[model samples]
Target chain A: MTEARDHVVPRRLIEKPAGGARLRNLGQYLFLAPALVFMLLTMVYPVLSNLRMSVYDVNVATFLSNSAPFVGLDNYVKVVSDPAFQNAFRLSVYFTIGSLVFQFTIGFALALLFNRSFPGNGLLRALMLLGWMLPTVVSASIFRWMFDGGNGIINFLFESLGLLDAPRHWLIEPNTALIGTIVANIWVGIPFNMILLLPGLQSIPDSLYEAASIDGATPWQSFRRVTLPLMRPVALSVLLLGFIYTFKVFDIVYVMTRGGPVNATTVLPIYVYQLAFNFFRFGDGAAAAVLLLLPLSIVAVGYLWLSQHEESSS
Target chain B: MNASRSNRRPGWGWTVLSTIIVIGYLFPVYWMAATSLKTNAAVYASPPQIVPWPPIFKAYVDAVINNPLALRSILNSAIVGTGTMLLTLVLASPAAYALARLNLRGATLFMLLLLITQLLPAIIIATPLFVLFSRIELVNSYPALILADTTFTLPFAVIVLRPFFLTVPTELEAAAKIDGCNQFSAFWRVILPLVQPGLITVAVFAFLMGWGEFLFAITLTTNETIQPATAALNKFIGQYGTQWNNLMALSTTVALPIIIVFASLQRYIVGGLTAGSVKQ
Candidate 1:
């Protein structure tokens, strides 16, 4: 409301010094100052430092030395050229796309199912939250066990039900491990997507559905016309949020496969960790991570845009 | 025949559909519990033990006491989680109040900036962060981790709590101001009493964000003493194979507090969660 009167971007609010309440603003800023300083120190500084690192080919072993060759465009060239880097890039795309596809499909289906009335719906909703609420590492650990070769319950069930001809190498095989991790992640992520879409469902008025019924529309047609169109914003938000969350998913892949069966599921976050911790190439790791951060930062930019739009409208 | 069957069924399709959905969600938790009980040998049994051939209490016991870090990690997680919750409210409440009630300079801009920070995935700068902490010579320190984890969580609390702060009518603050009170006095004595749900929401947001944190805890502190139970789960696997039963047992133990908090405070959470997602 005030922004229209002021007409400014990054618009400062009207600072009323004459009011008795102005003194409290001092205390408020004082309180918020530490968090602001902390963000600047830890988050802001490191981001700028990585941006600098991305432009230079600073070697790992001799990073502390001033004499380490600074080859401009070399790191980017090497990153784009190196087969391992390429493979990691390919695998990250594969993982992101595969996970997002399944996550969207299953999440939408689950949302549609749970959105309806049923016996024990409340208890079932609470139960569904279990897969989402437990820490990611725990989820990964359970998945790791389920994929175990010998006594693994997955293989036991599959073979017993004649789903597989033999005990499958669920994690050990390059073919199955990526799919397995995606499956595990799909299970974990469905609840979140459903949670978002559920409220979206609730917000859609029953009158609309009743109107569609009076028009002799089938349940499917009513849903197609009335529900899905209205749900676009929430669905869009869920999609964006899902991308942000899944793109940074490190725990499941780290724990279950550790960027393996021979680096099949080596998504960007896992690749970043491996380059730093396992390979001790901090600069290289930082560089790879910077490349990944660009897309994520774009999403953050979108979030900022939405927030501003919300403020002006509100 | 189709019309008769459909009429006779009477929403059984929806019933069966919901049952399948419920099963899909329940099966994983069941799997986790089932595996936690089975003997290592029986975990991979051919027929899969309906009940573990000989269920093990040993993993749970071992997880609680064996390396001793297990217990300490839990304590560390609790302290850090609580500390983050306190710090988030202490800092965020005032800012949220100022944004909601006090016409501070560029309150919306400040909020927009903070919201940007919340979406930032912490993984991007993990390497520099480790080195930065090392230069301060505080890499394995609790303060090192808490301060970092708070960065991840504080923006969320501030954004969620801000909307609640605004809902407190300007009239209340004005009344306090008119009654021989300074701005801070009015905020403290009168305004705060009204925003309890927002505060609870912030506290819960802070605690859970800190509780589930992993990247910085793993990267910044490699020590046994200061790490969280989150990173300790990584210790279960080594070069040879995983210690699965113990891992699940430890997970169950560590997750107890978070589950309890969610169960108790879920109502407050759902109210603010929408605002946080948009504003944050």
Candidate 2:
């Protein structure tokens, strides 16, 4: 990837003939034109428009007319001051960190498990992707059924094992609702993390582990020394990617609990959605949405840098 | 397969443990399928029917026949999915080819733009898009939904397809050019055909996204008549709160197309996923 990126410019300069080079450049731009135009209109324009909307007093009337009184960070202030913002912010952190810690650990465990060859290894790995491949709505809804209070299978299992005194409604109780969504998100995420980590694990040379074992290292010690250290870059990439995906989650939480049992699962994306669509507070919503971008941008930059570093280092 | 490191055949113990783990992990998917096949009595049975002993198609029948809403939403989803797939392919292929084969100025900038576009939350894009579409009277329309779906798909398609194009040696295009083919024909005729798998992978994923997309479908379209399957399924859950059998049936139906595609093309799709994200 780095080789392709680094040498593209000079190769192009040499490849193009002097005559009609400008016209060829223009023609090449034509190939990119449609996608560029569509992206500009849809993605780039929306982001800029969202930024403009964030600072303006974009009420329903002003939003429709495309003319808003410039409130100049009032929207941001209003959103930040709201108690819901704080709760949502806290929940977002809890949800993201909680989801990441479990998803990575469990996923890494699965990756390690599958990293060892066994009969049906490839098939099992592929099958594990079922959860990840299903639409988030479907996953959330299935979880919703399983977490039901009265007849939910989760409750049934809990009661059968005597884990709970009673069958608690997981998604209904405020205390457990966020956990419920987090569990569902974890399930949705595990397969992805496992898949990402598998390649990292595979990239490790087997001779290192063999040498470690020959040096009287136990299997556990060899894993801790050889595998974990070697897997660091890929693990970081997986966690960063997982954080980005988990942080902006909306559909799963919305579908599972509608971000409630009294604001339990109301993460930042849900908060933004509620502000923008349900309450028609577009400006405030845009402000909150823009705020969500800050951490993501930092992480995205980190991710890009890390990926490039991995490429060059490898 | 690195497990046979010492030249020892993998023990069946590993297979047994792995099988048990896979089964436990996939139990939810099994439950979804099982619940979909169960009769209402079986659905409500205490301790729940792990397997539909006497499986019935009543829920499937009910979801499809008794509920016009389910069928209509599916049809709407199909339209959106197909439209998004076509639009993404039409736009993405050329763009990917350009990025791969041509050294246009600001190529790095464009690549950066594509990456940043993907990182923006759907909510962020949805907020502005809703307002903009409303101004242009495009809300509550298929085009609106399809276009919104494309925001994610287009970037993904280009990213995935560009790798495929890169692997196709520039010599192929050069050879075609030497044979009197122009740049457009060389790309249209030679390069496009070579990346068929990538195109299919991108198309399948784009379609899946369109079919399963919830946020834009819900936020951009208020009319029940125009909403896609994911949004309609959410509404179904709300309207028919504990009708687990029907909900699972609807969910299963909505999920079947994607599952089928994934199963058949697991290799390419998996490869495409790693290529799109990790780029290593």
Assess every candidate by TM-score. 0.88, 0.95
B109: Cα error in model 2, Å:
0.7
Candidate 1 lDDT over B73-122, as tens digits, reads: 88888888888888777777777777776556767677766765655667
Predicted candidate 1 versus true structure: per-residue lDDT over A92-195, tens digit per residue: 77777788788777777777776666556556666666677677777887788777876677887788788988777788899888988988898788777776
Candidate 1 wrongly placed segments (more than 4 Å)? A1-28, A56-71, A117-123, A302-314, B1-20, B52-55, B278-280
What lDDT does candidate 1 reach at residue A227? 81
- Mind giving the per-residue lDDT tens digits that candidate 2 earns over B1-280? 2344523776577788888988998888889889999888888899787879778999999876678878888899999999999999999999999998787898888888888888888999998999999989999999999999999999899999998999998888777665556677778888899999999889888988898899999999999888889998999999988989889999999999889988998887787777787772
Count of clashes, each model: 2, 0
RMSD, every candidate, angstroms: 5.8, 4.2
Give interface RMSD, per candidate. 7.4, 6.1
CA lDDT, candidate 1, residue A205: 72
